[model samples]
Target: MRTLRMILLAGMAASALTAPSAGAAEVTALDLGAATAARLAMGHVRFANGHDYNATVGFGSGAFHRPGDPPGTLYAVTDRGPNIDCAEIGAVVGMSAEALCAGDTAAKVFPFPAFTPTIYTLSIGDAGVEIVDALPIKTRSGRPITGLPNPLTLTDTEGAFDADGRPLTPDASGLDVEAVARAADGSFWVAEEYGPSIVHIADDGRVLVRYVPQGLEKDLAAADYTVKGTLPAILAKRKLNRGIESLGLSADGRTLYAALQSPLVNPDTAAYKTSRAVRLLKIDAATGEALNEYVYPEDEAASFTADAKAGKVKQSDVKISELVVVGQDKLVVLERISKTTKFHLVELGAGASDLLGSPWDDPKTSPSLEATPDLAAKGVIPLSKTLMLTAEGGPFPEKIESIALLDESTLVVISDNDFAITGDQTKVVRIALDKPWN
Candidate 1:
């Protein structure tokens, strides 16, 4: 049966290549060697309203429009259990497409237990983010496992449920979630925009640890010299503290770098001004302590903000979507505007003494120094190289929300189909970055 399932899956994948399409410009065929050399892997989730189905693919040419795909074609693995009334969207990783398509018992893979029901970004390789086999997660109660959805089933697939099988929705108070670093051990650390700021989950969907930003608040206040908002409130705000948007970790996993999806307000400002600068934070992973926090230079911030105010930018929000530590001192940042994507190569240097400066003292005006001294004291860094608009003019204009490195030269990008009434197309795109990032 397993052998038969594998054969059928291969055939289905082959057929997928020729799936009917509305005529659009043909994209360059993916170079598998370049993709493999870059060590990229791609995956995405799908969102469907009754009339149309959209599947978001990771690292593909943004969203592809397929007006005729079946409603239950895409699948997502959730933390809810089987007894709970939920839709079976698709098979989890390692399940055969044939078995999933058949909706048979043999198609059953794993079950997600105690994992938070939310959207997640996955990593492709071992360095920062990588895939993991079915593994038990450490829990306060006991050991818990992950599960996959049966793609063939088409019941209620939209929302996640609680232990009582009640549907769990993002509350009226929006919840913030950001994909942090993929650990060397193949697990992922997610920073929340709300309280209990950190959550570590294994790839198979098991909760490991939840870190609350309690102890770090005092230090963060001391470093930035402002404390109008709590850690949780900063994370929960939809426009600003868009929870854990970017994650960067040291090679050894001791230090962490985080960026918010939107600009953090200067606590002193009455009508807070938004800056193009991305916040760089150094965290102690073991203790969940924010040792230092710094902002990118005002010059860089002005470059992007000026364009945004002039309506010359594709996206209004200068969100840092993804972060990867290249070496000890180098970091790769993926910046997303509505239709444009930019890659920035940042260089880490010594810490600064006054990272906040006048921003903490007088929010109404700009600071004297282009850069903050506290950031230097806290070991904040600068961008050494940058790549802008690397992948544009593809199938659908992308709102890239997640990214993973397949290898040194390949990257998998995922688009979030925001579950709109108009039926947005979700896409996963694979790009081969063969050239130097300068």
Candidate 2:
């Protein structure tokens, strides 16, 4: 029996490696233990031509030079299929290739057709996670939309609509949208790097409200209020501080955790060094007001940066990507660099509280933070069970972009394919979270 099982397992891995391109990969029979969820719900931004680009690049292929010699393609595994319908949105018309390619010619000549947003539902079956349906989402104005690399398109245009077919404007300037999170109520919040930093959108893609970090009203007030001139100009003047990139709400749906995508630069410094501190700000879910800011310890920041600079490690940036609430006051953060993805369990200390004054807010009462030096001192506690998913299956290259928990014990991971048309592959994979991280 052991011999037979070994053969079957070897064959499965082999088949997976050489599987012909067809529809998306599917799983029909998964033997997950009781600790894991039976049905995993997953969401991602997939391209029609089976290519995915980094949210940063917007439209073009992500190609760069390694430290040594020739430049190579930055292979992303997150772009999978169920192509976008660009015509549904205005993306197909009057669309400039500026966002798609790094070079002018590359942007003008990229071959993929324009597309609009379509939700593809995947079911875990005997085969694996497979696409069950592709449903088109309509805006309040009755037009279809797709995601683009530009923040204005991703946040301001893709998911929004006015009553009379005009775009619902955001309140603050330079609100370049980077990522999005859906709420339990079906409403969505977009994380923008530029200010009017965050925008709240209704299900029909209407801009219901906007959230700006405190202390920026004067700068915004000085600008003419037109999204084009005001938002980007202010963002540029402020040295392009891309505020928030990742966002997650509390399990109870009252508190929000927003992660800054990059370090803030000190204008006084001659050369840009990684900010000594990276912050995870807590906010009131109801009002989108700032509750508290948690800064990473200096030692931890130094260690992360050293690893990246040494070339011994790849993901040196240590940007926080996504946050998940695990227990009452405990949260899990997905921190990624160019080459590493780490899952951290953070306990915001007691006295660290939320807007509603829930017990979970009092860091003094919570063990994760109260016993520690300060709420910010606890730094990110490394969970023993870590999964080192590679860019490729083993030696192959893949770039993981986004992750979502289908339940407590199952994780859905998506890779970005960097929109390469040849010599690249996109993947969406699932793994058990119950496995030992240590």
Candidate 3:
């Protein structure tokens, strides 16, 4: 069985997504169990509800690398702590389903209610992955910010509960950070899902300014950090929990690229589930203004041959997970289903339509951009894409949310383990291309 598995991985590694392929790509797997074991040994995590999750680091939320960082050294961020929806609360916590989940708002159970999201500096080597340093995301007052959902007055809000089935209050400062990009000055820009917001943090981990969709400023007024409503108003219509999930920063740190995880519920939820149009934005890093917006069409569900043969799947299953900047106007977009992942090289200049102020961005437009059946028929041109890599089956783990390039010819991918909520372990895969990406 081991020999057969190795042969399968070798074959899969040789498959290149782009044209003019070289030879087989080198593949390596790094297990993060050592970091988890080390954390447990030091008692780094304390569960308030008495439920020991035996959790992993959950470092796959986002990844970043400064221009001059050493090879094999990258930074990763964690999402909201170990949590499960209401449906599994009964079995996982051995508690009544109605106690915390049956109220006016359904709440997710957080085993570590006070857990804060953190940034980890990782060293990837032949032996395994190592955690060299860690930084906690905090507020200006130096108070660590929890991962709980924010209490917003304008848009939708999700509630949360502690492990003991105790309802937890919504915090305006809470952030469900999904992606991070480091600035030249050593500060950080993070993409979040709760307010579906973008936040700028200082070098010491203090939030400098948070930019949300227009009209959300009033909602986050009480937040300790400065809040700005600079993003387009239409972005507020994004599907719940499906917000900005991918972010990339230019080497000069003057521009940023951000993408929504899935199509927005422009017309309604039905349109969102069936739509292929995903919004990607190019923003001015200094001003937080969206300079341009382009539509990124996701792949059809039937295209994933192996996954479709197993069972039924829908277009909604495909989502944008991460974005990596490779050139001045070029990026690598990571989109995936649960079992299959694809990396596409996308260029921002020319031949692509910028829909910044078009009707597609207007909230009052009927049959919204997401609902439009044919954008080409309306003279709209989405970004042109070239497939760079298609990874599935052996050596590729599910829920791969973060990706980075170690060199011109090497790619690094990380999978989110959900803090071992379902017995999943955080895994990292390193792929050395036969030829350089340039």
Candidate 4:
């Protein structure tokens, strides 16, 4: 595999990867390697915590699309820092939850409790990729926020330890920021996996407000920042680690669209795994209120990683990593299930039914949205989707987690490098769409 990686790198140096769009049209690509001083800083963190930095520079999880920026300039975000497998954890498996919080932490990953999610301003071109500037997300009081998980009382969570196997407590301000969008006022809206919440960050990175599910609004209100439970209450059923994963701002910047990573744990895990209907929430950014919800149905599997398709893995493999608003009411959604990543042009037509807090949410409904024999027959018109491109047979990165608009005619993509684990490298790919509006 290392040799293949070397050969791949050699080939990459000679030519960038290219893949076909629909029809005879092909989306040409320009690949840029990202190098930053941040890797050296993380190297120290790795040695101290026994957590190796997989990639050279690790800021490649979520993406923030900034329109009208200087050409070749784009923004991307990093999620909670590098994580390790359970077997890689440095502690005993069955330690008491209480004991896990009092002592020092020995967690193989997250040993540095102070690791913060970072936003990167990337300048990408044929020359290469470089960080123009970086911003560290912080709390309302101007304190840096960690990437650690929130406490279990508020939601499902995991305990933390240090490299030597000691206990650590949860931090309320911790955020696993996945999707980001820049607001007109220079502030930002970030979608977090923890609260499955939408957080407002001042231009300087202070958390201004957070909107989460209704039931937990009060639970997290007393934190050192503002918290509101304004998203649809049904969102409370969001599956673990599979909350809002992608965010986009409407052209006018008045509306925010958030895509759930996978099906919610509404009826049960079994139902969620096989369910195809994932939810997309349209929210009023100013009020932090859910204006409407649309469904993106995962079609019957015609293609999937053999393992995932063979029943060796859970059926909840399909996920939405990032979505961008291209046309007036049309969204360019990046959908993937394992090695196959496809871009779909979805339109939020006004004729579609609003599924927020609808009967489809009732656990008792015989035909769950996932099981609905025919959504259209029941007057439930899903957001119209048109195939744009598929990377199944293309030269694309493994985890293209974020996408942004470089201009009305171009799109840019970034992949989470997992710090380069398994030889995956962070790359910036410039895609000139066949149709900018598509």
Clash numbers, per candidate: 53, 55, 0, 13
Candidate number of the best TM-score = 3
lDDT of 1 by residue, 1-438 (tens): 011111111112311111011111122222224333233222222222122222221222111111122221111111212221222323222323233323332222112223323433333322222222222333333334222221111111123333222333322111234454556665656665443245566665455555543333332232111122222222222232343566666767677666655544443222123444445566677765566555543223324432455565432255676666666656667776655555666665544332433233233434412223344443444334444323333332356665544444444555654432124433444444434332
Candidate numbers sorted by lDDT from highest down: 3, 4, 1, 2
lDDT by residue for model 4 over 257-333, one digit each (tens)? 99889888766777788887888888998899988889987644545553255465445777888899887668889
Clashes of 1: 53
- For residue 216, model 2's alpha carbon misses the true position, in angstroms, by 6.0
lDDT score at residue 344, model 2, on the 0-100 scale: 60
Deviating ranges (above 4 Å) for candidate 3: 1-24, 33-36, 40-52, 94-96, 103-105
Give the CA lDDT, 0 to 100, for residue 99 in model 3.
67
Report residue 208 deviation for candidate 1 (angstroms).
3.8
Q: Which 10 successive residues of model 1 have the least lDDT summed?
A: 1-10
Ranking by TM-score: 3, 4, 2, 1
lDDT of each: 0.39, 0.38, 0.80, 0.70
- Given candidate 3, what's the lDDT at residue 342? 80
TM agreement with the true structure for every prediction: 0.52, 0.52, 0.92, 0.85
Q: Give me the displacement of residue 283 in model 2, in angstroms.
A: 1.5
Please identify which of the two predictions, 2 or 4, would achieve the higher lDDT against the true structure.
Answer: 4
